[model samples]
Each structure stands twice: as structure tokens, then as C-alpha cells.
Target: MKEVRLPTIPEIVIILGAFLALVFSFTLFLDLPIQLALFISWFFVIILGVRLGHSYQDLQKSIMDGITNGLEAVLILVSVGALIGTWIAGGVVPTLIYYGLEFIHPSIFLLATLIICSIMSIATGTSWGTVGTAGIAMIAIGEGLGMPLPLVAGAVLSGAYFGDKLSPLSDSTVLASSLSKVDILRHVRAMMVLSIPAFVITAILFTLTGFVYGGRNIDTEKVEFFKTSLQQYFDIGILMLIPAVIVVVLLALKKPSMPVIVIGALLGAIWASVFQGIDFADAINIAYKGFAIDTGVAFMDGILNRGGIVGMLDTLVVIIFGLGFGGLLEKLGVLKVIIATFEKKLTSAGNVTLSTLIVAFLGNVLGCAMYVSLILTPKIMEDSYDRLRLDRRILSRNTEVGGTLTSGMVPWSDNGIYMAGILGISTFSYLPFMWLSFVALGLALIYGYTGKFIWYVDENSPSDETEYKGEKVANDY
Candidate 1:
């Protein structure tokens, strides 16, 4: 096997320039608006890629590859948009909110938010879907309950990410497991050693905070009005659930995503026409451009009205740019260089673990996309893990705990921005209360450095020279 070497000095400088440009673009202290910063960053990346021996054709190819890599994510995101619209059009979200408000005490709302999202994420295998829908509802319920916005946002993020890390349905989970050559189920089970403890600690903290905050008076009448408006606009029923069920069923069968999402969008349109009395043209329009309801309630408008291809375009754009940058870094060997420099210094299992955690975290901070971070980090660390005789599951878990958890904490990152925008809370404001994410990272680091729960491959393990019971067990790990 041929080993890839680190970057040359010029390549390092180019990589540094890309980082600086991205930082300058997103730096609030620089007094540049976010739009301008993003534009500037894109410009800088293009110039830097060209200077680093990438031709226009290469850049285009990179963009195409990046978009292709993210196609599944993109389809899921768009389906999520339509799903949110359908859920609203069918009154599913409003019903959840109304019922949530009735049952949840204000003091425990944050904790409840986390638990609910965690359950939904686990079931759906999609943190993004949980956030875009149930997460949105939770934010509204939190506001009605008078809980602090940041705390509510933090709790929602904490729960959503917990599921993303452990859920078999999650793309990040699947990606990590696949890249590391681990069975998906095994990967998820192995993560329990670290994930469960982090979740428990986070839940406890949120529960304590909820008790400290106490309950508040909610506007029952206002919530009732929103519920009434939804009921009036759309036919609310168990049948409205068909679209979600179909999507899940398809995903479970491991079908390609684009066709599934397209079907989902069609189902949304069909539901709108059949149940809401919307004309075919209007239903199609709503599915593509989002639904608009004249509920005459501002807060209701904020919560109940969302969906469409247009709504997902921003996130899609970000995914494209982020992945493009990551691909360029990979091609230039900049990421490889950094990982090699760090790997050479790690002599013990403890060091390898810590280094993996740090690498994962840095990838999140730099790439801000969980899949990008996972893909880049593992490739960089694969040889190191082999040298240390560490089980691949450990590296996979570390990557997930670091990348999937921390991406939502960085305001400028894709997940962070989406969570903040959807929840109507700033990432900075909610970051302090996002205890689970930080705790996950901390636990990973501790596990890495202390070797407390680090699993290693056994040297005395049998070779795959002979099969046992019609199966090869020696080479399984």
C-alpha cells in the first residue's frame, strides 16, 4: 500500500489562507455582515484552490464531487422541508405543541425538550428532521412556557444530537460506521459505553436547571387559538402520518434518498389536496414554495408556517460550499499533514484516543459538517489506530462524539446556524447551556487520555487462516 505524505510548505500556506479567509468571513468582530462574509469566504476559497494547482475544471469537478457526496443529505433536507409543511398543513405539529403545553411544566420544559427530541431523533434517525419539526414545536412551547430561549435551544440541540450519535437511522452514524468498516448495529451498540453516560449526565443537569427555574403561567387561550386555526385550515387525522411513515419505511429498506424524498414531496401535495381542499396547482405550489396560513396570530405564523424547496436551498448551499472546502483540503494533503504531525507524537493508546478526540473536535470546528469531519478524521487516523492496535469502534465513537455533538455548538457551522434559525435563538446564547455536547467531548477526551474505557484489539486473537462453523471469525474485528 502506498502511504500519502503531508503537505509541502506552499500547500500549508494555502490551507492557512483558506482558514484565515473563512475566519475573517465569519468573525462578528470584523463588523462584516454574515452574507458578505460568506461571499468573501467563497471568493477566497476559489482563489486559494486555483493557486494550489487546481484548475477551473478541477474546481468544478471538486464542486460536483462535493455535491454528489452530499446528495443524500440534500434530499433528506428537502424531504424534511416538505414533511414540516405537511405536518403543519395537517395540524400534527400544532397538536403536538398544544398537547405539550398542556402537559409540560415550565420548569421542566428544557428537560422535556431534550427527551422528546432524543426519542424522535432515535426513531427517525435524523437529527435535522427532529430539529426542523419537533424541535421547532418545542421552541414555541418553550416560549409559551416562558423558559429562556437560549436554554430551550440548548436543550433541544442536546437531545437532537444525542439521537444523531446513537440512532441507526442517522447518516452520520452510518457514515462513521461504514468508513471505519464496522457493522452498523455493532457501531451503535459500541457507542453506548460513552454515549449513555454523556446523555445521563446531560439529562441530570437539564433536570436540575428546570427545577431551579420553576414553572410559569402559559397563555392557554393563545395556544388554543393556534390549534383551532390549524384544525380549521387542514384535516387533522392519523392518516396525515402516511407521508412520514412512508419516508421512514423507505429509509429502513436502504433505498436511495432522492426518489424517497421526491415521493415524500408528492405525498405532501396529495395530502394537501385531499384533506385541505387545496387545488392541485395550489398544493404543488405550497409544497415547493411553502404553505402560508392567515391564522391572524403572529406567534402561530412563526411556528406553523414553513416548508418548500426554497426553504432548504440555504442549507443546501452551505453543505455544498463546506464540502467543497473540505475536498480541497483533502486533495492538497493539508489535513493529512496535520493528522500525521499529531499521530507521530502519540505513542500510547491514551495518546491515540486523546489525539482522535482532538482531531475530531478540530474537524468539527474547521469543517462544521459532521459527515465531512467524520470522513476526514478517520482517514487521517486509520493508520494510527492500526499501529496502536485499537479497535475501530473506539475511533468511530470518538469521531461521532466529537463531530456530531460539537457541530451544533459552533454558530457559524451548518448545524449550528440551522438550529439557531429554526429555533429563533442565537447559537452563542444557547451554547453555554448545551451541556450534553460539551460533556460528550469531555468524556471522549477522558476516555482517550485515561484509557478508562478504551477497547483494544487482542494480539493473541486467532488468524483468519481457517473458517469456523461456516463463518470467518478471526478477521471480523
Candidate 2:
């Protein structure tokens, strides 16, 4: 057996600098596929690891561990692709679009998209569910209303993530609270200090943006074409919404997301065969290959022609490579080395808070999952907070800021890939419109610097008394 050695500071810099340069230049500036960039980065990091005396077998194990950790997210992405395909074939998505195009005014469409997605996410406690269902419908509605797809994508992501960070049912939220040993409800309360203001400001920005689009001359012809085309293709009606309703209800009841999504897909397949008159063979084909139709309306065709299991392949590539790269970095002791460096510099409450936030963000960037960040941040930073007498809930809130909020913006991340794949817009294109994230991140920094909302441990209280005063029950929306 061989012992692994940690890289020195300069060595860590060389590794991280090369990886970040490769990722950003290729994906952001060069406009190449993220998978390619991640692959190259992976190779570069492995070489550095070998040069530092680690064995190839050990490095391989690290990559595997990273990928293994994220397999559930990978599964969810695959399931979502199938769900979207089947739901579209079954008329569930079209019905939502039809109703949305009919009732949601252009003046409030962007604002409404944010608010509706926020509410749905809160209820379901899952951002992916809200995005895959309502997010899809809103993008189409925005297109019909002649709004820019990227702008709409921004609103959809903002709203989806807002609920995801705050909702008790949200996996990231629960993970953050449990990791800190803070009660989930108390964590939620502490988070509201940062999240609510960001939510309100984002909603306001969307409202103003919506009004700008509202005052423009609408292409009534295009809206009519979409509505008519949908009516011509599928049985658009109230009952078509049943599968979507079931998803929200079941998830709200605390059902696991993967099975609930698969159930939705199955119901959609049944509805496609029964109501839409799609044959059994065609339904199966749609589930795998996605729904397709020649609506003759180019815009309509673009929006409707998506979904299926295969549709997620491109996203899966990025996830696999990204996770592998992240895992390799961990194996090479990049995270540990970096944390040790930061620990020496922790001089004040503000510095500790800021460093914790940076580490949390790096966890998502390097680890490829908020779950990884949520787990790693607290396990590493809890002592730092305690050293300063800062409440651990403050640490939990920062995790949501750096980990959960920023996850959607990284091109190779699961949320980022899923959003781009589902909305048919590039992550970079909508990155500017993720107002809530930008604002929340900014507010977190300010609070850290100014010491606002930074709670302290009550010295007079028992050391074991950390849980909030209330009945310990499962958190709801």
C-alpha cells in the first residue's frame, strides 16, 4: 500500500489555474462543447496528479468516486428527458402552453413566470420538477409572446432556484440544514434574511422587463398560429393536465422525485395512446426519440420538437466529464489543500463568511453537485463558525448562496445542462438574467462584510441547545 501526498500551494495553483482556464476559455469564450473542455481539463489534472507521485489506479478511483456520488442526479436527468417527451406527446405541456398563451398577459408574463415557478418549486421542493414542467411551458409561452428566449430562461431559472433554496422539501435546503445540525425550519428562517430581498428585487426587475415587452406591438398572428397548431396536433383540454397535477401532488406529499417523474411519464404515455390516439408503438418511440411534428409554423416547430431519453445524452456527457474532473481534483487533495490555505487567513467574521462562501461555490464548480458542496462546506467550516461564535445557520445560508444558487450558472453542472437542454438556450445566454442568484450572492457578501444577519451563539445557553424552539416535524413548502 502507498500513502498519498498533498500538493504544495504552488502546485495546487498550477492545477486549479490550468483547469479553470481550460473550462472558461473553451466554454465561455471559444464557444466549444463543455464536454471537450472538461475532457481536456481531466487529462491535464491527471498528469499533474501523476507528476505529484499518485498512481494512475488511485486517480481512476477518485474519478469513479466522484461520478458515483452524482449518479442519482444523472438518473434524474435521464428520467426528466423521458418525462418531457411523453408529456409533450400526451398533450400535458401543450395544454399548459395553450392556457398560458390565452390568459397570461405579456405585461406580466416574465414576472408571472418567475412567481409561478417559485410557488411550484416551493410546493414540490424540487427545482428540476418545476423547471421540467412549468419551465418548459413558460419558455414556449414567452416565445409565443415574442419575448427573447434567453431572458425568459433567466426568469424561469431564477424562480425555480428561489424556491429550491428556501423550501423545506428541497434536497439542497434539507442537506444544508442537516449538515449544520440546525433545524430545517430555523435554517429557512435565517435564510429568509437573504433570500426574500433577492426574490423581491428579481420579481421587480422581471416586472419592469415584462412591461418593456408589453408595450411593444405583439404579433397576434404568431400567437394564433401556436394555439391553432397545438389544437390541430393534440387533444388540448383540462384533463390533459392530470399528469402534471399528479406530479405536483405526489412530490408535495414527499414522494421521491425519480419515481414520481417516471410515473408522470407513464401516465403521459397512456394519455398519448388513449386521448391523443397515438399508437402504442409511436408512444414508445416518443418516449425514446422525443415528440416531433411539422407544424409548418417554424417557431412552433422549434418549441414543440424536443424531449425523449436520447435527448439527454449530450447533457449526460457533460455531467459525466464534469463529475469525473471534480472527483479527480478531490482525489488529488485540491479541496483539502485549498481549505487549509484559507483556514490560515480566517481573521474576522467577515473573512470567515466570505471564505466559506467561496469554498461552497468552488464545491459546485469543482465537485459538480450542490449535495457535494452542502456536505463538504459544513463539515469543513463548522469549526470556523464556532470559533467566531457565529450561528451555524449563517453557515448553512451561505452554502445555499454559493452552492445551490450558483449551480445553475455553471455550464457543465447538472442544473445548467438540464436548463439549457430543456429550454433550448445556452447557459451563457441566460446567465445574465439569473437576477436572483446575482443579487443573493451580492447580499451575502454585504452581510458578511457588514456583519448584518450574522447571528452569534448565545454564550449563556447550554452548549447542546442549538435546535430551534418548536416541535421537530418535517418541513413543508
Best model per TM-score: 2
The TM-scores of all predictions, comma-separated, are: 0.86, 0.90
Give the local distance difference test score of model 2.
0.83
Give model 1's TM-score versus the native structure: 0.86
Residue-level lDDT tens digits of model 2 in 21-40: 88789876998877787788
- In order of listing, the candidates' clash counts read 0, 0
Best by lDDT: 2
Q: Write the per-residue lDDT of candidate 1 for residues 1-477, one digit (tens) a residue.
A: 234344566667665666666565566566544434444555465666566566767666765665566566777777777766665665456667766766788777877898998987776778888887788888888777767778888888888888877878788888887777666776887788888998999999999988877465556676666557656666766677677678768866767655665676678778778877888788777766777787777877877677777777776666666666666666656667776666668777777767777777666566655556777878887788877877777778877876778787766667776777777778889889888888887887788778877777677753212221233333343
Model 2 misplaced stretches (Cα beyond 4 Å) = 1-3, 24-32, 368-372, 459-477
Worst 10 residues of 1 by lDDT: 462-471
Provide the lDDT at 397 for model 1. 83
- Give the range of the ten consecutive residues with the poorest summed lDDT in model 2: 468-477
